[model samples]
Target: MSKPIRKAVFPVAGLGTRFLPATKAVPKEMLTVVDRPVIQYIVDEASAAGIEHFIFVTGRNKAVIEDHFDIAYELEATLKSRNKTAELELLSRYQPPAGQTSFTRQQLPLGLGHAVWCARDIVGNEPFAVLLPDMIMKAETGCLAQMMQVYAETGGNVIAVEECDPALAHQYGIVGVGESKGADAFAITSMVEKPPKGTAPSNRFISGRYILQPEIFDHLSRHEKGAGGEIQLTDAMIRLMADQPFWGTRFNGETYDCGSKIGFLAANVAFGLDRPELNADFRKEIARLLG
Candidate 1:
């Protein structure tokens, strides 16, 4: 059997300039979607997918992100004193097992490639995952868990993909398909990051989740800047596709791009609507807005 995917890398080093003043004080990953922090949702998904080692590629002023995963000693103590077992158990899920979490400094704003490269030492030569914290996915099953199922069965580089409208293809890396594997997965032949509208090969756009082989480090190391004069992970993945197999799992999830203010607010509203206590109030507010 293929070795189980045990490690995951979270690229949370972005400045999150798009979120502006709100991000000035808080790391975007710490921003809440309803009640849970954005990064926590991704962590829960990874944990659910059986990922044991969690690595964070972070930068300056990102201490809050690290602290969020750490055990809050005083808070836990208070909860224990009060015997609020239910509340305490819920909070404990956020605290990763000791020694299972590791953090590395990206130290630069080079790009996603550099941020991912920063974690190579910790990742070693194992196939590791990269999950962008800005994208929060809500689905019947977690997106990462869904992709992990595909990776174990297929044993190749796998990415979470979603078929998007052709006009919106330029907003993401578009993947070209070779053949249909099954219901929700496809073999990728080529991919381009934000190619000009009509020039895009296909509408299967790359999302934030990637199950990348360690060999990608070689391609990323030698890769020149693409798209935005920054070394893009897609560029390296494109090169990796030439040699090995790359599968795209048409993601089954409602993804929220919390990198933008509008998307972030929308995620909060969407999540609120799912809450039993807030659903009625949220629906009323939404109706008022429409009216």
Candidate 2:
């Protein structure tokens, strides 16, 4: 029987070199998109997707991430005194119940698989979702939540993938076609991360969200280095396809690669447009700047 996905892993270990100077002291995941940090949106997405436990894989300079999820005692007290209930409730939503949130550290700048491996104990032997905090998707249902619905039927590994330009397929983990898992989604026959020039199996690339079965742990345990002399998650995931069914679902949303400075700024601007408090003024300012 297909089990529910109760846990999610947020791989937040990378040093945001692309966002230097600003990221030098602050964790990139903690960088605000629109009054909320990038990580907050990811967690909120997972929560909306019915995730019961949130596991974060962090690195140095990321204590702020922990602080972000915790209640600001002084701030809450002040807001309470001022009778700012709306603002207070907004802050409270960020906190998970006691023991609901957990964190582990990835000491080295290893590959994505290594970051996920750091959280294995928390995940145990169950199906879990992994989301890279760098890829921000603006969706009403949230990408992970949508993937969960697909997982309930596919009953195997599922990932969020989007179509990229044929020439740019080498920049992502492209997938091969199998069967139609959904009306539009494709069951993955194979996947290769950043294939050589003109060698990709398909134009669909792995987006940042994934719901994987526990069998992946076995593949990852014996996984060797690939693509960057680091244990790439894509490599292990590829092996997983051999033994288990793997499928990728395409969602309706624009994904900003906040791993890069340009993408980060784009997300900030896009999110601001969705905020009632900032949209009007921010758009005016942006328009004036462009002029």
Candidate 3:
């Protein structure tokens, strides 16, 4: 049996050029969606999926993320003195157990594969998960948790995929499948990153969640640059597929692409509407705005 996927790598090293002035001072993953920061959602998802270790691959100016995960002793003491039980409980829940989380620096604007590769020493030879903090998924079960079930059966590499409009298939890393495992699972025969407009082999695109084997490090370590002159994780995965089995599971949820402006606004609204305190008034305000 394959080693259990105990650790998850979060690639948050990118400079959020798209988010502009806001990102100039803050890491994109530190941006708030409704109430919680984007990285927190990814961490929550991974934690729910039984991920024991959280490895963050960050870059310069991203120190806030590391601090956010650490305990604030003075604040905790102040809350305790004030008898703020509820607030203290909430704060405690956000912190992972000591030793469960680790942080490393990428120190370059390379690519996803390179960012993941930075975690090589910590990951060692164990199968680990890679979750992009930008793709915040809303599901009955966390997206990574859902994929974990598929990993238990497949015991190789598994990626989360969702169908996209054929016309827009060129915008994503498309996967070609050989057979269906079930309504929500398939065996991936091949994967192509951002194919030409109408030449994509399949309309289904790879979403941000991945359960990868350790052998991928060997492929990524080559530092070979692919599309856009950077080391692409998809390229490494393609190389890994030459030897191991790869499967794709269609996750059950709405994934908001928070990497873009519109996607970020939409996610805020979607998450706002889901909040018990805000739902009713928020829905009415949205309807009024539409009207």
Winning model by lDDT: 3
Mind giving the per-residue lDDT tens digits that candidate 3 earns over 31-147? 999989999999999999999999999999999999999999999999999999999999999999999989999998889999999999999999999999899999999999999
lDDT of each: 0.88, 0.88, 0.94
Report the candidate with higher lDDT, 1 versus 3.
3
Using TM-score as the measure, which candidate wins? 3
Q: Where does the lowest 10-residue lDDT sum fall in candidate 1?
A: 221-230
Q: After superposition, how far is residue 166 of candidate 3 from its true place, in Å?
A: 0.4
Candidate 3's TM-score: 0.98
If both were scored by TM-score, which would come out higher, candidate 2 or candidate 3?
3
Q: How would you encode candidate 1's per-residue C-alpha lDDT over 1-291 as one tens digit per residue?
A: 666788999999999888778889898899888888999988988888889999999999999988888888999999999999998998886788899999999877888998888888999988988998888888988998899888878888999988888898888888888887767778888888888879899898888999999999998888488767888898888888878899989888798888878788889988899999999988998999999
Off by over 4 Å in 2: none
Candidates sorted on TM-score, descending: 3, 2, 1
Candidate 3 deviant stretches above 4 angstroms: none
